[model samples]
Structure formats: structure tokens, C-alpha cells
Target chain A: MAELTYREALNRALDEEMARDPKVFLMGEEVGEYDGAYKVSKGLLGKYGARRVRDTPISELGFTGLGVGAALAGLRPVVEWMTHNFALLALDQVVNNAAKMRQMSGGQLKVPIVFRGPNGPAEFLAAQHSQALASYWAHVPGLKVVAPATPADAYGLLKSAIRDDNPVVVLESEMMYAWKGEVPEEEFLVPLGKARLAREGRDLSLVTFSKPIKAVMEAAELLRAKGIEADVVDLRSIRPLDEESLYASVRKTGRCVVVDESWPVASVGSHVAWLVSHNCFDLLDAPVELVSGEDVPMPYNHSLELAAQPSADKILGAARRVLYREDI
Target chain B: MAKTAKNGRNTLPPREILFPLLETMQLIRAFEEKSGQMYGLRKIGGFCHLYTGQEAVATGAISVLDLSRDYVLTAYRDHGHALACGMEPAPLMAELFGKLTGSSRGKGGSMHFFSAEKHLLGGNGIVGAQIPIATGVALAQAYEDSGGATLCFFGDGAFHQGALHESFNLAKIWNLPIVYIVENNQWGMGTSWKKVSAQSDFVATAAAYSMKGLVCDGMDVLNVRDVVGEAVEEARKGNPVFVEARTYRYKGHSMSDPQKYRSRDEVDEYRRRDPIVFLRSRMEEAGLIGEEDWEAIVQRTEGLVEEAVRFAETSPEPSLGELYADILA
Candidate 1:
């Protein structure tokens, strides 16, 4: 195993996939020569040349739809949006065309395309830019959504997404790009719809995905200090959610607290809370708590922005409430 | 009517080559006439847009394509384009009937017919959504160095969309192998182009991107064929061309359209120059086809449309299990 940053792992995934498949090409604004806005595609331009690592105009709807078209025409395209904030401009293409092409066309076509970029709240970049729209993608039917938190997962899941025969959205985090982790030297694929048991404990289930995994892991340590072990379920894929693992963990712990960076209303966290509440209705010690972002626009102030998002302290509070140990 | 083609050709194509163009146009005409009748009889439901008077635009442009490799896409007024690309009429009718044997297995209705084998990407539902998708398809054609071109069709209504501008810019800068054909049917639904567009000349819109721009009498099959033929060659050389086919749709935008915006006299004027009649007359004047040949062509198309209706009526609705299928890989 070798240590690599999240950005390096994603770059490795892109490099490996493009090298493996001649049909694979990368397209986005500043992806070539500029080496990508986040440098997640560093050195791809030199390695693959302009035809493969293409730099596009600031046209998200056009390029995203073009990527879908390329996929329909038998080319695997990885179209990068500089950020998910800008992806909103191309939502019509993502939601209308990419999400519905397969089923709408009666399975005649497969949109083997990946729309990858940094997502979720980062420091100082407030309101429009600091939004985590994972639920928006997860809500769609034909599309698959994956938010990888670790360097290993960033590598494996991205490779898997590129190889996937359906349109997949890879939700990378700007904040986690510099975070380093050990990844396998040899090729590996962490299959979608599978949850990683980050910490196996029995007191309560702490479920989360994406950047919140770090805070939740830290919260798990805080719980361990209080002589209360918790089961941490990191949902790598959001759309084909690993419900079986979540249910299993919730059933074992008999309590659950979901940590999501997106706002509460109609969000992935709410859906998970509902699933646990409905399916595991009988197997609960206390109500399933949801620790989500504030149901308001992200404030520009650093302190307010941090408060708007779910933190380790917030997660710990939710876990304690779910475990009936709030006094502790 | 020995008309010279716009490609500087002394004469049009040979009788064998020209006969299929008329045949395909007739087939599209017959298919659409039947589809309108079916919609009236309550056999078809939802948004059923008929391609009545604009048959030549689809036939003329599509005839030049090598369908084995080339891609065809269009807006919802797509049955003609689908039929022109050699998609069987029965499945298309079955799609309108929402049957299991439909091209999209009844999932995609009138607005969404697709055939992977024919390289007909889709009859997209949105106004100008196909432009970027078609541009991307051309991106593939260029990346693979395939000697193929993509024909993307949209209406005058799609001109105002930002997708059109963005797609054209990319097509020009990337030098993708795509031909964008605007079927300027004079109206964008109920609203006339005069009321909507700041620039009425659809061909001039291509100049904004520095792309090759061409125009054709969409009512004339030979003119369309010549212009689109030239554009296809230019596209294959990685120069995207935009062609404005000045045509008219005889029917309402959809079955539900009142068409109160235009007078019956205006419809009559365009009808007098019907593409089907124009092509048949050209063929007859050139002594290429006799009255018997025209009769035979009509009979064949009518027979195909009749068989399609029968097949669609007989085909069962999609099974309950199919509802949950095809949403993912």
C-alpha cells in the first residue's frame, strides 16, 4: 500500500481508466493545461494529449449533454464540473437527459458517463458554492451517486464509476482533497451499494458519507472515551444506498444517528432516517436522530458557516440523545 | 423539371437514387397521416406531434447518411426522422400505441423513439436538448476518427434556447462532425418566429460561431438533399455546418394546439407547395416515374402504415415487470 492524498488518488483513477480504455476521455473547463481547477486532473493533459484531456468552454449544460451524447455514441466520458455549485446550471441536462436516457429510450442506450467534481460545504465559500446537493442526485432513478471520503475509496469508486455502464455522479469534496490515506498498490474496486463498517461497535449506529465521515469517526472516538462504543457506517454510494448494511448496523445497535452535510428537508439523511424508522420500527431503543446541516442558506461568516454544518460535537450530541446518555 | 442541385451538379441523382427519397418521404407522410387518424380515434395518447408537411427535410437530410455509422437526432417532431433513418414503421407505431413491441418497448412514447441499431440516438422531448447531445455524438465521431456525421434537428422554437448557442460554440471550436438542421417551420408552437426571435434568419445564427452556414428550400427534396449532402461532407472533415431548412408544418404543434395564431389561407399556401407533390412532379417531369410507379409507391406506403397500425393494435401492453426495468445498468 502507498500513501496518497485524496486528489492524487482521484488523479490516479482517471489516469488508470483513460490508459486502460481508449474510449475514455476527460472533458471540462480548465481540465487541460490548467490541470483542473482543483488539480484533481493534474498531468492528464500531458499524458493523454488535447484530444483526450479536453478543455471546454464555460458551458456546463452543453458539455454535460455532450458527455451523455458521447456515451450514447459508445465513448466513455468523464465530464468534470469545476464545482457542484456550477453543476446547478446544467441540472436540466443532468436530470432530464442523463438521468432518463436509459429508461426513456427503453434500454436501447447506456450513458456510460461520469460527472465528477468537488461538492459540499468548504471554508469561506458560502451560500451558492458551499452547498451539498447529494440528495438532488440521489433522488434521481437512472443515475448512481457516489461520495467517496477516503483516498482508497476515491481511487476505487472513481474507477468503478468510469467502468459503470450507467451515468454516475462522483461527489468529491474540496476540503478532503489534501487529506492523505493508504491505498492499495494493486488494482481494486469498492463496489457500489456497499457500506464500509468503519468502526464496529454495538452501543449505537453512526451513519454518514462524504466529508462528514471524518467528523463522525472523531465522534466515534469521543463515544468510545465515554465507555460507549458505536457502529460507524460510511455509505460510499448514495443512490443504490447500502440499506442492508445500514439495517444490519441499526439492528445490532438498536439506535441510530445520521450525519449529513446537506439541509434537512427531503434530503438523503431524512430518507435514511425514514428507512430506519419504517423498516426497523420494532427494533429501536430510542428515536433515530438526524444531524443535518441547518435548514438555511450557508452564511458567509466562518463561525456561522461552521455552525451551519454538522460537526463532531453536533454528531456526538445526536448520538448521545439516540443512546439515552445525554447526561453523560 | 430537370433542376440542377445546389452542389453545382449539372443534374440530380439517378432515378434509382431519387426513387427511395420519394419513397421514404411518402412513407413518412403516410405514417404521419395514419398517426393523426389514430390520435383522433383515441388509439394514441399524450403529446402526439405530427410531421405532416415537413417530410422532405427529414428524408432529404437523412438519405445521405450512412446509417451503419452515422447518428441521427431530433426534437419531439421526430417520427419522420426515425422513419427516414430506416427504423421500422411497425415499432414506431407500436411506440405511439405504447405497446411492448414499440421501439422503446412502450416506455418512450411519441416524443422518445430510439433505435441503437439504426444509430438514431433519440427523438428528444425537450426543445433544444438534442443539440449538445448531438455535438457530443460528433465528438465521439471525431475522437474515433470515424468517417461519420451526426444530423441534429430542432424547430424554430429551439433557437432561443441557450443550449443552441453553447452547443454551436463547442461544435465550432472543437470542429466536431455534426450538422445542425433547423426545420424553420415558421412557428415555435403557437408563437410565430417574428414574435420570438430577434434574428429571424436562422442561417445567419451559424455565423456567430464562425461555422459554415447553408439554407435550402425545405419544401424541395432535391434542394434539401443537395445542401445537406454538402454539409455532411463538410462535417466529416471536422467542420460543423448549420443548415436552415425553411419548411412548414401543416398540422398543429401537437394534437391539442388550437393553431389560432395563423389563418387557414396561410396553411393552404404552403400546402400548394407540398414536398411530396413537388418531388413526385419533379420525378414525372424528368420522365423518371410514370403514373403507375406513383400509384405503386402510394400503395406500398399505405400498406406499411396499415400493417403498422394492425401490429400496434395487436401488440400487448408492456408487462408489469417492465415498469421496474431499464432504469439502471
Candidate 2:
């Protein structure tokens, strides 16, 4: 095992997959000779040559549809949208073609394509370039959405996504790419739709993923100091949600709190809360609490933007409310 | 004047190529006329776009390619393309009737016909959407060194879309083996070319992308075959080409269209230069077929169209469970 940053882990995954399958190639605005806008595809062009590590023109819809067509023709393509915000230009291809091709073609075609890039709110990036589109993509039935919070999980889940027979959306966090952890050097794949428990406790379960997982974990540590043992579960895959893992955790803890970086309305937090309530209503001692970003569009002011997103303090507050419910 | 064939062989014998084109055009004409009657009777619903005036485009394009290796992807006006690509008329009619025996298993009614065996990728409904998809298909062919080419067909209106330009740039940059044929039928639904396009010349647009451009008289099957043949050959040599086929539609855009945008006189004028009639006259002048032989071909096509109708009428509709059959592999 070796320590690898989240960005390095993604690069390793791409390197390994491209080595194993020639059909697995990378294409994005600056993925090739530019060494990737985020450096996630760094040095890949040197190793795989220009054809496999392609740098596409600034046409998201065209390249995305090209990826879909290549996948249909039996190639596994990793299409990088610089950010999830840019994915809007390619939404027609992602939602209409990539996600629905299998169903539309009556199972005759499988789009083994990955649309991976940084997503969610970033400091001072303003409204256009910052959005958590996991909920939007998760609304579609055919796509598998994943957001890995750790270096190891990032490498493992990306490998799994590349190998998946269906289209997968790997939503990376701009703020977490530098986070480092122990990652295995050998090949490993974390199966999609499985939840990973980062910490175990008996008092309350703090369920979160992507960038918010770090906030929830910090809050869980704070709760431990107050003699409240809080369990932290990271939902690595959003589409084929690991309901069984969630239900088992909620059944043990008897109370749960969801922290999501997306807005409060119609968010992934809402869905998680609904699932916990629907499945473990009898086991729960208190109602499920949701801590999500505020409803307003992400502002440009640093402090205001910080306030708009769910913070560790907010997760701690929600955890306290869920654990100390008087109605229970 | 001497015509130069790329392979240095004499041009294909007149009857050898001409009869197939004539037969395919006759089949398409008969099939569309019968389909129009069926649609009028409410047997087939949804958007039905007939290719009555553009038969030569499909017939000529398909004739010039090797069906076993080449792939064809087109827009909504795709029945003639499908028929010309060797999809049995019966199954195609069944598809339009939303029956199980149809090519797409009845899921994609008119606009989204698909047959993998024939390499007929799709009859995509979205305007200008298939351009990139077809370009991608060509990219894949080049990547795998499959030595195959993809023929992407779209209307002149499709050139107005951003995707077409984007696709053109990518195909040119990569030297993808593709031939983009713009069937300029003068009208996109109801809007004429002059009303929408600021620069009415489609060839100049292709020139912007650095790809070879050609403007051909789409009414003449021989001319279409010659021009498209050159482009397809260039595509096989790993250079993408763009062609603007200047043709017209005798019928309305779709079955429900009232023809309010253009007058009856315009429609009558296009019919006067009908590709089928032009081909028939050329064949008759060359003594390619006697009057009885021509009548026999027409009778055979009528019987085939009636057989297709019978097949569609008797075919069973897909079951409720089948709705879930084709969504995933």
C-alpha cells in the first residue's frame, strides 16, 4: 500500500484501465497535452500517446455524443467535463443518449462510458460553475452516479465505473482532490451501490458523501467528545443506493442524520431521509434529520458562500437535534 | 467525353446498376404511397414523414456503398433509407404499425427505426442530433481500423444546428471516415431554406470545416451515385466529405401537415422533375427494358406493397411486458 492523493488515485485508475483495455481512452478539453485542467489525467498522454489520450475541442455536446457513439461501437470512453457545470451543454447526450440508449434500443446497446469531473459548490466560483448535479442525474433511472470521498475509494470506484456495463457519472469534488490516504498499488474495484462505514458508533448515524462526508465526519468526532457515539456512512454510489446498508445502520443506531451539499429542496438529502423513514420507521427513536445547503443560488461572497453550504457545525447541530428529540 | 473510374475499370454496365436503382426507387415509391393510405385510415399514428420525392438520394447512396461493411444513420425521413438498405418492406411496415415484427420491435414507431443487422443505426427524431452520433460511428471505424465508412444523412435544416458544425470540425480534425450528405429538400417542415439560412450555400459551410464539399442534383440518381460515390471513396481513404443534395419533397413534411406554407404549384413543379420518372425515361431511351418488362416490375412492386400491408395488419402488437424488453442489455 502507498499514500495517494485523490487526484493521483484517479490518474492511477485511468492509467491502469487504459493499460488493461486499449478501447478505454480519455477525452476532454485539456485532458491530453495540457495534462488535465485538474491534473487528474497528468502524464497520460506521454504514456498512451495522442490517440488514446485525446484533447477534444471546446464542444461538450459534440464530444459527449461522440463518446456515446464510440461506446455503442464497443469502446469504453472516459469523457471528462472540466466541471459538472459544463455538463449542461452535453445534457441532451448524457440524459437522452447515454442514459436511455440501452432502454431505447431494447437492450441491444450498452453505453460503457464515464462522464467524470469535479462537481458541487466551490468558493467564489459563482452560480454558473458551481452545482451539485448528483440529484439531477440520479433522477434518471439508467445512469449510475458515484461520488468518492477518499483516495482509495476514488481509485477503486473509478475502476468499477470503467468496468460497468452501463453509463456511470463520477462526480468528483474540486475541494477534495488534494486529500490523501492509503491506497493499494495493485488492481482493486469497489462495487457500485455499496455503502462504506467510515466510523462505527451506537448513538446516531451521520450519512453523507462527496465533499459533505468530510464535514459529517468532523461533526461525528465532535459528537464523540460530548459522549455521543455517532456512526458515519459514506454513500459512494447514489443511483443503485445501498438501502440495505443504510437500513442496517439506522436499525442499529435507531436515529440518523443526512448531510448533503446540494440544496434543501428535492435533494439527495431528502431522498436519503425518505428512505430511512420508509424502511426503518419502527426502529428509529427520532425522526430523520436533514442538513443540506440553503435554497438560494450559491453567492460569490466568501462568507456567504460558506454559509450557503452545509458546514460541520450545522451537521453537529442536526445530529444533536436528532439524538435528543423530546418526542421520542 | 470519357469518364474516369477510380479503379480504372469501365463504368458499371448500364443494366447492371440502373435496374437495381429503378427497382429500389419503385419499391420505395409503392411502399410510401401505401403507407400514406394506411396513415390516412388511422391504422398508423404518430409522425409519418414520407420520402416520395427523395427516393433517388437513398437509392443512389445505398447503391454506391458496401452494405456489409458500411453503416448508415439518418434523420426522421428514414423509411426509404431503411428500405433501400435491404430491410424487408413487411417488417418496416409492421414497425410503423407498432407491431412486434417490426425492426425496432415496435418500440420506435416512425422516427426511431433501428436494425443492427443491416447496420442502419437509427432514424433519430431530434433535429441535427444524429450528426455527431454518425461522426462518432466513423471515429470508431477509424479507431478499430475496421476499414468501414459511415454515411450520415441529414436535411439542409440540420446544417443550421450547432451540432452539425461541431461534428464537422471533429470529423475533419480526426480525418474520420464519414460522408455527410445534406438532403436539401428546400423546406424543413414548413420553413423554406431562404427564410432560415442567412448564407444559403451549404457547400460553403462545409468548406468552413476544411472538409471536401459538393453540390449535386439529387433528382438524378446517376448524378447522385457518381458524386456520392466519389465522396464515399474519399471517406474510405480516411478523409471525411460533405455533400449537399439539392432535391425536393413532393408530399407534405409529415402526414398531418396541410401544405399551407408552399402552394400546390410548387409541389407540382417538383413532381415534374421526379427522380423515378427521369430514371424511367433514361432506361426507356436506352432500350434497357421493354414496355412489358416495365409493367411487370410495377406489378411486382404492387404485389410486394400489398403483401407488406397484409403482414402489418395481421402482425400482433407487442405485449405489455415487452415495454421493458429493450431498455437494457
Candidate 3:
């Protein structure tokens, strides 16, 4: 095993996939000459040449739809959105064409494509750029949404997404790109629709994924110091959610708290909380709690921006309430 | 004006060339007319857009394709294009009927018809949505050096969409092998193109991207073939082109349209230049097909459409379990 950054892990996956399949090509704004807007595709243009790693004009809808078309014609295209914020411009193609093509064509056309990019808030980019938009893709049927917390998960999930026959949306975190983690030296795959047991405990369940996993883990540590143990469930994939794992953890702990950086309404976190409360209603010691980003546009001020996100403190508070230790 | 067979790529004898073209157009006409009647009887449902008057655009342009390789895409008014691409009418009719034996297994109705074997990508329901996808298909063709071209069709109603301009720019800059054909039937549902667009000259939009542009008399099938053939040949050589086929739709936009936008006199004027009538007159002037041959062609098309209706009527509805299938591969 070797330690690699999340960005490096993603780049390796792209490189490995492109080398494995000649039909696999990468296209997006600044992915080639600029080495990716976030540098995840560094040196790919040089290795794969211009044909495979193409730099597109700033036409998201056009290029995204083009990727769908190429997939229809039997070419695997990994289209990178410079950022998930910019993906809104291409939502029509993503939702209408890529998501519906296979079923709409009565299973005649298979669109084996991946749409990957950084998602959620980073620094003080303000409201438009600092939104966690996974729920938008996850809400739609016929699309698979994966959010990886570690470098290993990023590498494996991305490779799996590229090989999958349907359209998969890989939601990466801007803040977690530089975080380093151990990845297997040999090839591996972290299959979709599975969750990893990040930490184990019997007292309570802390379910989360993506950048918020770090805060959840920290919150678990603080709870451990207070003599309160928590099971940290990192949900790797969002759409085909690991319901069995969530149920098992919630059933064992009899208490659950879901942490997500996205807004609370109709969100992944809210959905998880609802699922646990509904399925584990008799087993629960208390009502399921949810720790989410403030239900408003992210502010530009640094302190307010940090306050708007789900931090370890906020997660701990939610844990306390769910565990009936709010007074302590 | 359409070039003569001697001057164009069509080296077939006049009778062989002219007869098949007329037959294809007649088949499309018969199929659409029957579909309109079925729609009125409520046999077919959900936004049935007829290609009654604009038959020549799809028939003529798609005629230039090597159906075994070249790809075709269009907006929802796709029955005509499906027939032109050699898809059997039965599955198309079944699709309209939403039956298990339909082209899309009843998942995609009047708005969506797809045949991978025939290289028909699909008939997209959204306005101008197929433009970028068709451009991408052309990109794939260029990347593989396959020497195949893609023909993407959309109505004048879709002319102003940002997706269309974006696709045009990408096709030009990348030198992708594609022909973006705007079937300028003039009305975008109830609103006229004159009200919706500031510039009515669609061919001129191509020059903005410094790409080659061509315009053809969409009312003339032979003329559509000549222009589209020239454009496809250019596209295969790495020069994408934009074509505006000037035509009109005799029917309302869809099954439910009242068509309060235009007058009956306007529809009559375009009807006088009907593509089928124009071709038949030219055929008579050349003595290629006599009156009896025309009658035979009409009978053959009507028979084909009747058989298609029978197939669709007999086909079963999709099973309840099918709803959960094909969401993902």
C-alpha cells in the first residue's frame, strides 16, 4: 500500500482506465492544456495526447451532451465538470439525455459514461460556488451517485464508475482533494452501493460521507473522551444507499445521527435519518437526529462560512441530543 | 433547383432513382396520415407530432446516408425519419401504441424512436437536445477515424436554443463530421419563427462560426437529396456544415393543436407545391413512371401502413415487471 492524495488517486484511476480501454477518453474545460481546473488530470494530456484528453470550449451543455452522444455511439467518455457548481448549466443534458437514454431507447443504447468533479463548499467562494448538490443527482432515478471520503475510496469508486454501464455521477469534495490516505499498491475496486465501517462502537451511530466524514470522526473522538462510544458509518455511495449497514448500525446502537454538508430539506442526510427512524422505530432509544449545513446560501465571510458548514462541534451537539446526554 | 442524375452522385438510371425516392416519401406520407387518423380515434396517445407535409426533409437528407454506418438523430417529430432510416413501421406503430413489441418496448412513445442497428440514435423529446449528442457522435466518428458522418435534424422552433449554437461551435472548431440540418417548417407550435427569432435567415447563422452553409427547397425531395448529399460529402472530409431545408408542416404541431397561428389559405399555398405531387409531375415529364406505376406505389405504401397498424394492435402491453427493468445496465 502507498499513501496518495485524493486528487492523485483520482488521476491514477483515470490514467489506469484510459490505458485499459482505448475507447475511454477525457473531455472538459481546461482538462488538457490547463491540466484540469483542479489539477486532477495533471500530465494526462501529455500521456494520452490531444485526441483522448480533449480541452473543450466553455460550453458545458454542448460538451456534456456530446459525451452522452459519444456514449450512445459506443465510446466511453469521462466528462469532468470544472466544478459541480458549473454543472447546473449542463443539467438538461445530464438529467434528460444521459439519465434517460438507456431506458428511453428500450435498453438498446447503453451510455457507459462518468461525470466527475469537485462538489460542495471550499474556502469563501460564496453561495453559487459553495453548494453541495449531490441530492439533485441522487433524487433522479437511473443515476448512480458516489461520494468518497478517503483516497482509496476515491480511486476505487471512480474506476468502478467508469466501468459501469449506466451514467454515474462522482461527487468529489474540493476541501478533501489534498487529504492523503493509504491506497492499495495493486489494482482494486470499491464497488458501488456499499458503506465502510469507519469506526465501531455500541453506544450510538454517526452516519455520514464525503468531507463531513472528517467532522463526524472527530465528533466520535470527542464523544469517546466523554465515555460515549459511537459507530462511524461512512456512506460511500448515496443513491443505491447501503440500507443494510445503516439498519444494522441503528438497530445495534438504538440511536442515529446523520451529518451532511448540504441543506436539510429533502437531503441525503434527512433521507437517511427518515429511513432509520421508520425502519428502526421500535428499537430506537430516541428520535433520529440530523446535523446539516445551515438552511441558507453560504456566506462569504470566513467565520460565517465555517459556521454554515457541519463542524465537529455541531456534530457532537447532535450526538449528545440523540444520546440523551445534552446536559452532560 | 435539384441537379440532374447525370450531374449528381446518383448514377442510377432515372427510373430506379426517382421511383425509390417517391416510394420512400409515399411510405412516410401514408404512415403519418394513418397515425394522425389513429391519434384522432385515440388509439395512439401522448403528443403525436405528424410529419405530414415535411416528408421530403427527412426522406431526402437521410437518403444520402450509408444506413449501415452513418448515424441519424432528430427531435420528436421522428416517424418520418425512422421510416427513412429503414426501421420497419410495425415497431414504430407499436411504440406509438405503447405496446411491448414497440421499438422502445413502449417506454418511448411518439417522441422517441430508436434503432441502433439502423444507426438511428433517437428522437429526442426536448427542443434542440439532440444537437449536442449528434455532435458527440460525430466526434466519436472522427476520433476513431471511422469515415462516418452524423446527420442531426431539428425544427426551426429549436433554432434559438443555446445547445444548438454550442454544438455548431464545437463541430466547427473540432472539425467534427456532422451536418446540422434545421427543418425550417416556420412555426414553433403556435408562434411563428418571425416572432421568435430576430434573424429569419438560418443559413446565415453558419457563417457566424465560419462554417459552410447550404439551403435547399425542402418541398422538393430530389433537391433535398442533392443539397444534403453535397453537405454529407463535405462533412466526411472534416468540414461540418449547417443546412436549412425550407419547408412547411401541413398538420398542426401535435395531436391537440388548434393551429390558430396561420390561415387555411397559407396551408393551401404550400399544399400546391406538395413534395409527392412535385416528384410525380417531374417523373411524368421524364416518362420514368406512368400513371399506373404511381397507383401501384400508392397501393404498396397503404398496404405497408395497414400491416403496421395490425402489428401494433395485436402486440401486448409491456409486463408490470418491465417498469423496474432497464433503469440501469
Q: Candidate 2 docking category?
A: medium
Tell how far residue B128 is off in model 1, in angstroms.
Answer: 0.4
Error of 1 at B133 (Å): 0.4
Cα lDDT of model 2 overall? 0.88
Highest DockQ among the candidates is held by which one?
3
Give the C-alpha miss distance for residue B303 in model 1, angstroms.
0.7
Residue B15, candidate 1: C-alpha displacement in angstroms? 1.1
| lDDT tens readout by residue for model 2, B160-194 | 89889889999999999999999999999999988
The reply for model 3, stretches above 4 Å from the true place, is: B1-13
Q: What residue runs in model 1 are displaced by over 4 Å at the alpha carbon?
A: B1-10
Error of 3 at A125 (Å): 0.6
**Interface RMSD against the true structure, candidate 1:** 0.7
lDDT of each: 0.92, 0.88, 0.92
Every model's Cα RMSD, please?
Answer: 2.1, 2.9, 2.0
> Clashing residue pairs in candidate 3, if any?
none
Please give me the DockQ of candidate 2 compared with the native complex.
0.60
Candidate 3 on B77-186: residue-level lDDT in tens? 99999999999999999999999999999999999999999999888999999999999999999999999999999999999999999999999999999999999999
* Cα deviation of A5, candidate 1, in Å: 0.6
